[model samples]
Target: MIKKEDDFFSDMYQSINRAFADVIKEFGGFEISKKGFGFNPNFDIKEAEHDYVIKAELSGMDEKDVEISVEENLLKISGEKKEEISDKKGKYHVSERKFGSFERSFTLPPEIDSSKIKASFSKGVLSIHLPKNEKANTKKIEIKTE
Candidate 1:
């Protein structure tokens, strides 16, 4: 019974994921229309004590192909993933990988220091660190009783 339930939930989750992907393909965001490709890399944004870190998973992509920019509070990550299908190889029996260009934009908090942003790519993962401004640093406040 447990196995059946797990399978049912897994199937439902997969269905939802497929549907979401279809929607993304149908309605691309940012530079989706310009690129004519439907590949959006997954990313995670985290907040630390003095910085905001964004990590994006971009398998099969070179660091040179990706570009990062920050304007005001808008952060943009754009890249092109070249198709790896070799002309020398025979027709693919199954091709599931996607190729082309994709861009994702995020609105960062105003407290971040865009000038001090740092970015690094390693092992198909892109990490961006946005240092917090001096005014944004955490500080304890005490209330004085009158």
Candidate 2:
């Protein structure tokens, strides 16, 4: 009798799980994976009087692992986070950390002087300073009425 009850509950649980996955697929047009996703860092952009500052939070990453470049008006940031090897004898009950390569790009304004841009990394945070061209700064014009 106990075996029959266990089988019934197991069947019900699998049916419910399939129904949930079907609903998610119907709405999102994609199936959820059990593996996991890549590591994408969060960023913040701030504008100052003469320059724009971009900061990216990349925890558990070294400065050498990250790369920054500019092509035309696009600024690109790419990096890889390697996973550590664990003990073969140990078993993991829950693993939630994500490790992989990620790339992010942003379009820079025409007034920005890319040649003079500067970058610094400290405490897992990367900061890029984009200075604006003085000649390209916005100017006000006075209109004469006839």
Candidate 3:
């Protein structure tokens, strides 16, 4: 009787799984997976009196792997996260870490002084300082009688 009950439950489970699979196939087999995809890093942008600052959180990455550049009025930041190799040979039950190349671009304001921009990376964080053009500062003009 115990054997019969186990077989019955196993058959029922298989049947349900088949039914679900058939439904998914009928709906064009929609699947969602994040494996082997580039991950986006969090960024913060701040505007100061004389400059703008951009900070990005890029953990598990080295400074040499990242690149920053500006062209015209656009600022682009790109980097890659490489997967580490293990010396020991073993099967992995579950792997959730993301590793790939990522690129992010921002449209810089005309007031920014692209020639004076500076960037630094430390502790897995990237900081960019965009100085404003001296002439871009607000100035008050007195009206004269014509």
Candidate 2 achieves a global lDDT of 0.82
Best by TM-score: 1
Clash pairs for candidate 1: none
Model 3 ranges off by over 4 Å: 1-37, 91-94, 139-146
* TM-scores, each model vs. reference: 0.71, 0.67, 0.66
User: After superposition, which runs of candidate 2 have C-alpha atoms over 4 Å from their true positions?
Assistant: 1-37, 138-146
TM-score quality measure for candidate 3: 0.66
Alpha-carbon RMSD of each model: 8.7, 9.6, 11.4
Stretch of 10 with least lDDT, candidate 2? 1-10
| Model 2 CA lDDT for position 68 | 95
Each model's C-alpha lDDT?
0.82, 0.82, 0.82
Better of 2 and 3 by TM-score: 2
Residue 71: error of model 2 in Å? 0.8
Candidate 2, residues 77-134, lDDT tens digits: the string is 9888888887778666656566778888899999999999999999989999999999
Q: 12-108 in candidate 3: lDDT tens per residue? A: 7667767787788788995432222345788999999899999998889988998999999999998888878887777666665656778888999
